[model samples]
Target: MSAGGRGGVRATLSGLTTRGRSFLAAGIAAAVCAYVLGQDDLLRVGLLLAALPLLCAAVLHRTRHRVTAERGLAPARVPATGEARVRLRVDNVSRLPTGLLMLQDRVPYVLGPRPRFVLDRVEPGGHREVSYRVRSDLRGRYRLGPLQVRLSDPFGMCELTRSFSAYDTLTVLPRVEPLPPVRFGGEALGHGDGRQRSLALAGEDDVIPRGYRHGDDLRRVHWRSTAKHGELMVRREEQPRRSRCTVLLDTRAAAYEGAGPGSAFEWAVSGAASVVAHLLERGFSVRLLTDFGVTVSGEGGSGHERAAAAALMMDTLAVIDHSDGADLAGAYDVLRDGHDGLLVAFLGDLDGGQAASVARMRRRGGAVAFVLDPDAWTREPTAVPEPNAPLPQRLRVLREGGWTALGVPRGASLEELWRQADRERPGPAALSGKARG
Candidate 1:
């Protein structure tokens, strides 16, 4: 069938009920009998019954009530397991009263239950407001609704439904916990000039012109520099601060194994969020690297800039999903770009090649890894066959390669686990220029 024809049939069927059809059928049969046998009682009853439905249908078919809705979401972005209020204001725009109006705001399954309200009567040009709270224990972006409003006759036989094409979006960010007071001692907490360089880079601004050149915008001329240098000098724009930590999150699906919210993937996400929060709190510029080489960096040391960066990070993390790609080592090249800061990684399951790629970061400053013990988290005894070396062996390799690696067991307290300080290790040798891929 043609799409329009099918739609028309469905629309027609939705507005009618079996009871109405039965009544119409009986009325028609009675009317036929009355006309053939000249029965007055049957004729009167049939005409009255048949006219009732027609009258109801005519009255409802012409129903033209319009409503303007304004939706409000308090704290439009919330952390997982957080509550937010959804308020809706509906204004009637018809000349006559609308029949019982039923309004429901559609919500995604993850965002708790849908909010519903009913108005017995909406007088012409009147308005009503309703509010409800919604909470989600998971993270992601969700659409609140295209409001569904239904109007029905007093007898409930005839009905009309109109969906307002307006929607509101909700973003549920990952939960960030307070980091325990712990630092992997040694160069990981860069001392001396490294700290100074990090601070200086953080305070630097965007590139600006020191002296005006041809094709430069006249508006960019620095009046003070021109007065001092006897030439048209534009403010020099410099690059923003160099990020201090490259937070690489292993999103490769094969690395971690578990199910639902308790899976190793979620634990890795939480660990990443916690580490990012901790780095920001410690006044470090961070570059978030995920899914191989997708990098996100924030430039300024100012409070506003830091807050903006944190918000961006959380927003990005809220929507991160697992990748099917097995080789997550592609992020190493990007990590090699910055050599002055620490490298923090949340690793899932890993193969030898991937582990070796991660070890290359040792040439940089300090590298710390929070490795998930996938075997500990799996429920089935043989969820994954251990035909080769175990996860601890991989972590031992990481530790030997100048990384302060920690194996995280399932059901362990993140606060406690992260807080436990690692033993001091030798600093990485100074390596300049680009490292080979």
Candidate 2:
């Protein structure tokens, strides 16, 4: 539902309690007067109170019909946890003036309380615009609703409410951070790297000649070999094989054991985003496999690259199976068939079984890399070991697996590791030789 459909001034004042409160006070006064005065005074007071409600109701009916409303929200698309401003315009459509009009725009529950404002006066055929800010601290789709306008009689004995349907939808996307450059095998993969691989396949071993085709570079023609063979000869170039990189993300919330701003899952997501961004930038086709049961295939071109990144961001907040002992192996099985590239796993803490799963993945022609968030050990370091801790043993198994493992200590940023990854990337000299060959 739109925000306009939620609570507004009209809705609040229209409540039976509000009207009852005013009527009860007037009744009480009449009762007090009746006790002090004679029966005749009580009868007269009863008529006055009764007539007051009718007179107020009449005034409300007259003024409410004259007011018209329009609603709008600026920058309709906002981040999931951000704020936006809404503008409401109320116009007096009739010749009569509208005085003391209360307006309330229906806001979604996710935005907290509905806002209420007052329109003191709207001259005949005149308009007054009111603006308020709303914040959405959570992610989702919200509808801003029917605008409500309220008018109360001058005597305050009665109230009338009018609602206008002004339908609008707002979509809040997930919050994203600037991902640091990620590297593979100490190689920096970004636009600045001239050594980035292309989709075109070129190698010395392939010598099969094919008929000349349109758009084929003239330098690739084998003129000498063509003349002897008496045919239009062109080099048959194979499509360049991209490095298949699969990001294995652990989505189990139980894996997140630590304190501070960075959780295990948060760090994992950041690392995954950075890695995906770097791979796409360097022309490596990347596929994402998350234990959250989300899979987005590798795509080419800048637009597809963006889609892949957004998919990752979307899955970071997606609901996962919270049941105890939910296996990561299920996610691995889903990605087992098609993944031929390096497998990078980010985990909270490892177990013997989980470690064995990583070993199985490595045996399937996938290079393994592990990012261990040490926050699982302890929020603050102490000499005494905590009970039921498996982090120490997990670290030991990871070290022996021949995997590139990095221990991310509590409060330590990933900037250094990112830089190190960049340093390990292949240099221009290597790329140039590969390209020329």
The candidate maximizing lDDT is 1
RMSD (Cα, Å) of model 2: 9.0
- Tens digits of per-residue lDDT for model 1 on 332-381? 77766655567778888777777777777654556778888787778565
Global lDDT for candidate 2? 0.59
Candidate number of the best TM-score: 1
Across residues 199-234, which tens digit of lDDT does each residue of candidate 2 receive? 234543346667788788988786765886897787
Full-model lDDT for every candidate: 0.71, 0.59
Task: List candidate 1 stretches off by more than 4 Å.
Answer: 1-14, 26-48, 113-115, 181-243, 379-389, 422-437
